[model samples]
Target: MGLLAAFTHTLEITLPVFLMVFLGLGLKRLGWIDAHFITTASMLVFKVTMPALLFLSIIQADLGRALQPDLIGYFIGYTAISFFLAWAWAIWRHPRVERGIFTQGAFRANNGIVGLALAAGQYGDYGLSVGGVLAGAVIVIYNVFSVFILSLYSDEVDTDFRSLIKNLARNPLILSVVFAIPVALSGIELSGWVMTSGGYLAGMSLPLGLICIGGTLSVTAFKRSSTIALDASLWKLVWVPLFGVLGALAAGIQGPALGIIFLYLGCPGAAASFVMAKAFKSNDKLAANIIVITTFASMFTLSFGLFVLKWLDLV
Candidate 1:
């Protein structure tokens, strides 16, 4: 009964989150959301709300435990290994452009709003801190490698080392973590209304963020490239997570942290891949396929990872 209950609740929460995303895609098909709305929502989330959420989350975190570079190293190594395998596989299967776009989908898991909400629910602020750092590392290496590999195979662009480094250096997630360091190190705290209000606002981060995330999906993209979508899905939703388990073990990562970190990497590729593809003049269809396929497929991979975690008594 306990097993059944746990299984049932996991389905209840996880499935609804995914369904909301698909429903957003369906709404897009009905013209309920268009270019204007997506742009506005993205800007609102990125420039303001997202940062506030990050600041609030990080402000309360015990930085000492969270800054465990050993764990960060495991995540970094695992990220590199997964990315290398993805690059190798995609190149063998597709051409330069297609491979570059598809490769990112396989390894660049979503660590955005939805992932944060789920992790916070299960592990509170500590989990968010761990997940955030792990996420930060993954984003850094993923963006660097993806752009570099694509550039190596493609033609000219105005983007130079300086510009690229600047963009990477100012990456929002990276910036959030970096900025939080001073606050964490000062051993200071938010005072009065700042403390009271910030906590409330921070509480808003998870659910509201998930809803906005659901509102952001696009059905049209999902139906665009079945081949790319299917291929990316199979590997991201299956192979990547399996590989992550082995990599985590090899990295000497143990306990609940290992599973949480690994499970996050199993998430579907972010929708941001489309923007990156356009920036690099890569295959947009493949990028959309990656976004749609891996996301839908990840519903399973995430659950399976959790099941493994439970089996191993890790979480």
Candidate 2:
């Protein structure tokens, strides 16, 4: 596609996704939805709806094609490298209490929400299937690193290895992936009613997740921590995605796999980072600020990245 066409195509996919976010913000500001609603919706999306989406996507995908080792390996490697590098930088630049938050904000992507939405919007079910698998794999790695790093820096005595394992085992996304992959590989068809129910829940995941993201964004927190917020946002929204996509392309990742990787890299710092930070006694305010800033900034970066990818005929 030509540059102009690519831009239009990219906007066609991204604009509606962002409009939902803005609508969510406007609704929250207008008092139609409040903090309680945001929290409950977030929990619902995370625990129920997102897992349902992943289950449906994975179960419906051709595992032999969708489960690409190269793609999964690249994401895992890139994420590990990024996590350590960000941690090193965080330690060098920030105080101990804030290091975990900085590192988490810098490295974690909102892959399940923003990344999945972008992938599904641009490429539909095929894109979502590929992206769903990638999201499942990457999120497992992210949660592991998040728990380890947060516990490492945590002042709390209760943060233990058992808790880490427990948290990972209890992650709904992880569970969905684990359960669905075997069934997918086995070629077992879900019962009609089960598929119908799952599809219904899956349909609600993205919109609800995005709105929760918007509703949770705090303008006051952004103002309070503008410097750190901007720094983390730049790392998350611009630097990580740019380098990651270039590396993925260089490594021969192409087509929908490449698009999903690009979207994953370009996704904002997840809202869950804030929750994890608070749970582990990191700088939750800074984490929240990073989430807010990166979530907004990614609208531009992700669209531009998609435009470039399409212009090059990469996806």
Candidate 3:
């Protein structure tokens, strides 16, 4: 009972992100922002603003305290398999263009919100940093895999290499990580003024991102697609969590690593799920529902997963 309460406590803290998501959806219903706004907002968060956030965080990280082999191994086992498995599932769902849409539910996740919230609760900033690295790697892999999946599901035999190149070129997170790698090696510190301003800007990135997300949750997407959402809930909410847990354990991670994996595994599907759906012109409805449901469902699994961790005294 005590264990369950601890899990729920953490979950309640994390639930606000969904409310923020709904806030975005509500704003969209009122026609305050549209798809173009979502694109713009996502771009801002992904490229310039959020990259600054990652660079600052990663830069300040105590490298000696960071970098655990078990954590890396766990994420490798958990995220890699899920990344590929999602593609295989979508490919097999052929003829149903909705498969690509549902695939986003499978492949994408609410890592930033759910994972960070839980990581902070469990491992504090240390755990969060570990989770962040894993999340970063997974995001890169996910981008690559999702593109390939879209090609197969879209049945595009001659996918333009230019498109892939452009994506990598424009991605802020990737660029920030690349930039940080060199700076991390250099071991230089940012000026006080720069740190102060960057910190302010970085703070704005997520809350603004959430508010924008809240503004763009489409009513049309909700009303239009039912079956696609059902499929998403089934696989993303249930199957993915199951697979992620077993895979993490099988890969020989425990303690902080295991806790971090559970936090990530318990994340609701990504808010970006809609992006993949629209890009492929697949089941946008299902993708949205999958995002919504998995997010809500995470309140349960996250709590349960956290409870398990608490019982094991990992935190």
* Candidate 1 lDDT: 0.70
lDDT of each: 0.70, 0.86, 0.66
Q: Rank the candidates by TM-score, best first.
A: 2, 1, 3
Those runs of model 3 whose alpha carbons end farther than 4 Å from true positions after fitting are 23-39, 87-96, 112-114, 155-158, 223-225
Question: Model 3, range 123-222, lDDT digits (tens) per residue?
Answer: 6667545655666666766666666666666753445668877877767776776677567668988899999998887666666677665665554555
- For model 1, the stretches where C-alpha displacement exceeds 4 angstroms are 19-23, 26-33, 156-159, 200-204
Q: What are the per-model numbers of colliding residue pairs?
A: 0, 0, 7
Clashes of 1: 0
Give per-model TM-scores. Answer: 0.88, 0.95, 0.83
Candidate 3 residue pairs that clash:
23-214, 24-214, 24-215, 24-216, 25-214, 25-217, 109-270
- Candidate 2 structure quality by residue, lDDT tens digits, 242-274: 888889989988888888888888888988898
TM-score: which is higher, 1 or 2? 2
Which candidate gets the maximum TM-score versus the true structure?
A: 2
Q: What TM-score number comes out for model 3?
A: 0.83
Q: In angstroms, how far off is 200's CA in candidate 3? A: 0.4
Q: Which ten residues in a row have the lowest lDDT in candidate 3?
A: 216-225
lDDT of 1 at 105: 76
- Model 2 TM-score (2 dp): 0.95
